[model samples]
Target: MLVDNHCHLDFPDFAAELDAIVARARAAGVSRMVTISTYVRRFATYRAIAERYHGVFCTVGTHPHQAAEEPDVTAEELVELSRHPRCIAIGEAGLDYHYDRSPRDMQQAVFRTHIAAARATGLPLVIHARAADDDMIAILREEMEKGTFGAVLHCFSSGPELARAGLDLGLYVSFSGILTFKRSEDLRAIAADVPLDRLLVETDAPYLAPVPHRGQRNEPAYVAHTAAVLAEVKGVSPAAIARVTTENFERLFAKAVAAEAEAGAA
Candidate 1:
């Protein structure tokens, strides 16, 4: 089974058909998914989705782009929200200078808040870094020195240095549909060198749809294509990639793992 470690199923793109979307994902071998939150103020909506779906889990935090709007979301607030069992991860938060929708300083502030929540709650942080590797590395190192926490660099497209930095800090690196893009040879090369146990796969879907599905809106079902491409890059079968990433997802999201065990035991 595969787990989409990151996606935004609550977005307007999936407004009318979560049923069909989730069904498609299951049929394509994605048995689990984490519907990420873009704003903590809307966490009830996120929690509702998770509660209604058997295999879906969620995170609670504001994205970096909206850092300006939710500037005061505290680590205490995040930790409290995370007490919900289905809220299995801490954020899709980090730096995104590509759009600069929020000021870099504000983004850094929000990112630090998320890191603190992760540290406090012992949940893995879902990091989203773009176009700000230097600052991202500097901040991650800064926070990491204070205390260690679990994390994954979601949809990684950064320089080799940043990738290495994340790995050095014991953070996992996840590949997305971007890895299957026509000009992503460089990314594939980077993917090849990463330690197998530290590599994960995702479909930051409704966004970067992989090849063959490149022109259309993406969904979790398309994670298969990205995984296959990743397998080719790593010179293993897709089933191997699926097994490893699923294990990695469970390892990082310990709450989800425990919940699954409780359900089965029930």
Candidate 2:
């Protein structure tokens, strides 16, 4: 079985056919998925999605674009909300200079709050870093110095410097459907360097759908396409890539694995 380690099923894009979307993912061997929280105000919506499905999970925190609107959100708030059994990680949050929707300093401040929540709750932080690589690297390094916390660079599209630094900091790196694009050879080169134990795969749907489904609204089912490309990039069989990433997902999101085990035992 495979895990689409990051997704956003709570988004309106999938609202019309949520059941069918998840059903197709199951048919594609996506046994579980984590619907990322782009806005903490909608954690309830994410929680409901997790509760409605057997294999869905969620994270809690704000996206960088919405950081300014919810500037005062604290680690305590994220920790308390994460008490919900469905919550497994913190923050699809990080710097996103590509859009600059929020002020750079505000994004940095808010990112730290989510990082604090991750450290406080002992949950992995689902990060999204874009064109702000230098700041992203600096913040990650500074934060690690303050105190270490688990994180994954979701939908990775950064350069080799960030990837190497993240690996050195013991952070996991996740690939999205973009890995299957025709001109992502540089990204594939970086993927090849990431240790299998620290590797994970996601779709970042309903966006960045892999080739063949490019320009289409993506779903968890398409993670297989990215995984297949990742396998080719790493010189392994698709099953091996699936096995390693599934293991890495469980290792990082231990709470999700625990919840799944409890449900299985029930």
Candidate 3:
């Protein structure tokens, strides 16, 4: 089964039809999904959704855009919140120069905090980077020097240099519906080169829906479209793509896998 490794089921857009959305995702062969956290304060919301759905999981962190709002949120706080049985990762946090909603310095500080949380908790960090490639590369390199940590460049849409930096540092790269756009040939080329073991697929739902479903509100079910396109780009069968990405998801989000195992045993 395929896994939509990253999504936002807690978003208001899916509020009324949350159950239907999960059902549709399962119907589409999406056996697991992680409803990402954009604000640590909303950890409960994300956790509740994860608790409600059998195959859903959650993360704990603040998005860069909301960095300024929770500037005081500490790595300790993130680490503590992540102890929830369903919370599997840390931070959709990083630089977002495109929006500049939070001061660049504040964003970097918050990102570092999340990185620290990842390092301490041994949970993968879900990074959100945009138009801040240089800083992202620099920060990742500098942070790696400080200590190694697990992370994924989620919804990646940056330059080859940033992608290369992440890969070189042993970070997984996740592609969203953006990978299926006609104008994303460059992105497809990048995806083609990413090692299968380190590749992941996501919907980034309520946002970048793939072609044929473009302009529609996205959900976990639509991850199959992105996976199909990725298979074409990687010269593999769709089933192979599903197998590789699901394996990658379990590797990167091991806590989710362990949690499932424990639930089954019980």
Candidate 4:
């Protein structure tokens, strides 16, 4: 089975067919899906979706793009909200210089707040980085020095240096559908170098659909295609990619794994 470690099921694009989307994902062999949060304010919506779906989980945080809108959100607030049974991670948060939708300083502040929440809660942070590799690396290194936290570079399309820095800091590297793009040979090279245990796959759904589905609305189901390409890049079979990524997902999102076990026992 495969696990889509990052997606936005709360987005309106899937509203009319959310149940069908989850069903399709399961049919496509996606056993789990982490529906990421982009706004801490709308966390209840994310939690509701996670509760509505059996294999779905959620996170809590403000995205870099929305940093200015919720600049005052604190680590304590995130930690409190993340106590939900299905809220398995801390963020889809980090720097996004590409859009500059939010002030850089505000973004950095909110990002650090999420990191603190992750550190306190022992939840893996779902990081979203773009066009800010140097700052991202510096902040990550500085934060690691302050204290260790579990995290993954979600939907990674960054340079090798940032990848190396994240791996060096013991963070997992999660690839999205961008890996299947024809122009992504450089990304494939990075994926190839990521140790099997440190690699993950995501869809970032409602966006970045893989080949054969590119330009279409992405869903957790298409994570398999990204895994297929990653398998080819790693010179392993698709099944191996599935097993390894699922294991990596469980390890990184250990809260979700424990929740599943608890539910099974119940």
Best by lDDT: 3
Question: What local lDDT does model 3 show for residue 100?
Answer: 100
Question: What would the per-residue lDDT of candidate 2 be over residues 70-122, giving only the tens digit for each residue?
Answer: 99999999999998988999989999999999999999999999999999999
Q: Give every collision pair in model 2.
A: none
Task: Give the clash count for each candidate.
Answer: 0, 0, 0, 0
Over 92-199, each residue of candidate 3 has an lDDT whose tens digit, in order, gives: 999999989999999999999999999999999999999999999999999999999999999999999999999999999999999999999999999988999999
In what order do the candidates fall by lDDT, top score first? 3, 2, 4, 1
TM-score attained by model 1: 0.99
Sequence-dependent TM-score of model 3: 0.99
Model 3: residues with Cα > 4 Å off, grouped in runs: none
Error of 4 at 166 (Å): 0.3
**Consecutive 10-residue window with the lowest summed lDDT within model 3:** 3-12
lDDT of 1 at 228: 94
lDDT of 4: 0.94
